[model samples]
Target: MTHIAVLGSTNMDLVAFVEKAPQRGETVTGREFRTIPGGKGANQAVAAARAGATVSMIGAVGNDSFGARLRSTLEHSGVETDHLRTTEGSSGTAHIVVDDHGGNAIVVIPGANGTVDHLVPGDEGLIATADALLLQLEIPLAAVLAGAQAARAHGVRTILTPAPAQPLLPELLAATDLLLPNEHEAAALTGRTDPRSAALALLERVPQVVVTLGAEGSLYATRDAEPVTVPAPRVTALDTTGAGDTFAGTLAVAITEGRPMPEALAWAAAAASLSVQRAGASESMPYRPEIEARYTS
Candidate 1:
């Protein structure tokens, strides 16, 4: 199996399902509510594991009930959590609202996630053993940069998801092997509303980029090759939460397994399609067999 390392955050997702999301300063009734285990890092870890990768998670959870559940959830999903630390105070949490259209809005509280500013003992070694390292912006930028740098030093491929987009440092870009961003995030990073334009612009900094277009699929670009566009499997979405992470994590597994870029992107898109058809984050990711079935259909 391809070994993947994840450096990111762990959060309990507090999700509210409603007919429509409330507007600013507005009160609206929700149909249902559920607390799900998530966080960009944890979601990716679970996605990759379910996709048949031997995944290890490196991050921190709080000394609260959510923290214990978070770690248990990862372990249950077959992710090794030897490097996942338990710190003081509350675990991270994402306050999420899902509308009937399958669209979502989220607010993240860093909590214990904010404390992971740097790698603790054994993090570098764990990263060094991986075929690929998955990263996201949910944790401290310092930790993200450090993880990327460590992966670079070990010649391990680093896949970064720049969600909740922010200005990135040159050093972090230099260390990243693949920069995966959704349409909105790509536009934010490159000032190009077009996904293709944004991906091309991103190639100037990172050698490779994948810009995800919801429903339409994903675009892959590299410094020295023609871009590839992979279409998503047509399906109705139930809750679009965690779809992007599903794509990123599954893509890493496909790539590490030596699938061609086009095939890899399509496989990842299949996983994302399955995720959106279900509710919650980590709970929604499909397993390897399900992904294969969807991709082949």
Candidate 2:
């Protein structure tokens, strides 16, 4: 089994679907609502687990109802939660608004997730046992750095997703094996609006970088070779949320299984294409069999 450890946040997603998102001081009626299990960390864990990896989640949830459901959801998706801690108080929540065009805006209220500012007992051991350590910026920077540092020390591949883009520390980039960022995040990080320029700039710090371009697929850059662009399979998207997480998770699984980077990117893109055709983050992830079929076909 491909063992992947995900160290990050866990939150309950409170989603509202509207024809269009509301503007400042404007209230718009939503067409639908849902409470979904998600956090960048939890979602990636689910995506990896469903994509045939033995995935473990190292994060914190609260002792509230949402927390319980979140843990169960991870378990249901075949993610190992032995390192998932339960803290006192409300769980983290992501207030999301999805527009008809499949775009979304979100506000995350960190509750128990905020408590994970440092690694707890068993965190390093769990991370050490994995073939890859997956990370995201949804949690505290210290904990994310700790996980990356541990992964680097153990020779485990570290894939860092720079979501909710923020300025990154040099130490964090130095430890990251692969940096995954969406187009917007890439632009924000490098102050360059173009993906090619942004990715090449990131490669100066990290060994490899993958800039996700939604329908345009993804771009892969590495120090050893020229950048490669892989096109995503075309599909009507119902919800674009979690597509990057899905891609990152499936790509990690594929890489752990010894697939070449190009093929892995194709597989991840297929998985992401499948995800956008559905709604919700973790709920939309396709299993390994489905991803394989999409990749081959």
Candidate 3:
């Protein structure tokens, strides 16, 4: 199995299902509410494990009930959590509102995640042993940069998801092997409204780029190769949360296993399609068998 290491945040997702999300300074009633385990790092870790990768998670959780649950959730999904530290505070949390249209709006409170600004003793060793290291912006930029540099030193491929979009440091991009961003994130990063143009702009810094287009599928670009676009399997979405993470994690596994770019993007799109048809974050990701079936269909 391809071994993947994830350096990111672990959050308890508090989700509210409603007909429509509340507007600024306006209150609205929700149909239902539930707490789910998530965070970009934890979601990718679960997605990779379910897709048959040997996954390890490196991050911190708080000394709270949510922290315990977050760790348990990752372990239950087959992710090794030896480097997940329990600190003395509240775990990170994402407050999400999902509408009937399957669209979502989220607010993330860093909480204990803010404490992971640097690597602990064993983090570098764990990253060095992996075929790929997954990163996201949910954690502090310091740790994200450190992890990327460590992966670069070990010659391990680094896949970064610039989610909850922010300005990226050139040094971090220099160390990243693949930049995975959604259409919105691509726009935020490159100031280009067009996905293709945004991706091309990113290539000036990173060697490769994959900008996911939700139901339309994903686009892949590399300096040495022609860009590839893969269409997603058509499906009615129930909740779109975690769909991008599903794509990133599955794509990382597919690439690490030597699948062609087109094939890998299609496979990852299939996983994302399956995820949107379900309800929660980590709970919505598909296993390897389900992804294979969807891909072949």
Model 1 spans > 4 angstroms off? none
CA deviation > 4 Å runs, candidate 3: none
Error of 3 at 105 (Å): 0.4
Position 253, candidate 1: lDDT: 100
Writing each residue's lDDT as its tens digit, candidate 2 over 246-283 gives 99999999999999989999999999999999989999
Model 1: which ten-residue window has the lowest total lDDT?
223-232
- Residue-wise C-alpha lDDT for candidate 1, range 1-297, written one tens digit per residue: 999999999999999999999999999999999999999999999999999999999999999999999999999999999999999999999999999999999999999999999998899999999999999999989999999999999999999999779999999999999999999999999999999989999999999999999999999999999888889999999999999999999999999999999999999999999999999999999999999999998
Task: List model 3 lDDT by residue over 189-260, tens digit each.
Answer: 989999999999999999999999989998899999878888998899999999999998999899999998
For candidate 2, what is the lDDT?
A: 0.94
User: Candidate 2: misplaced stretches above 4 Å?
Assistant: none
Query: Which of the numbered candidates is closest to the native, going by highest lDDT?
Result: 1
Q: What TM-score goes with each of the models?
A: 0.99, 0.99, 0.99
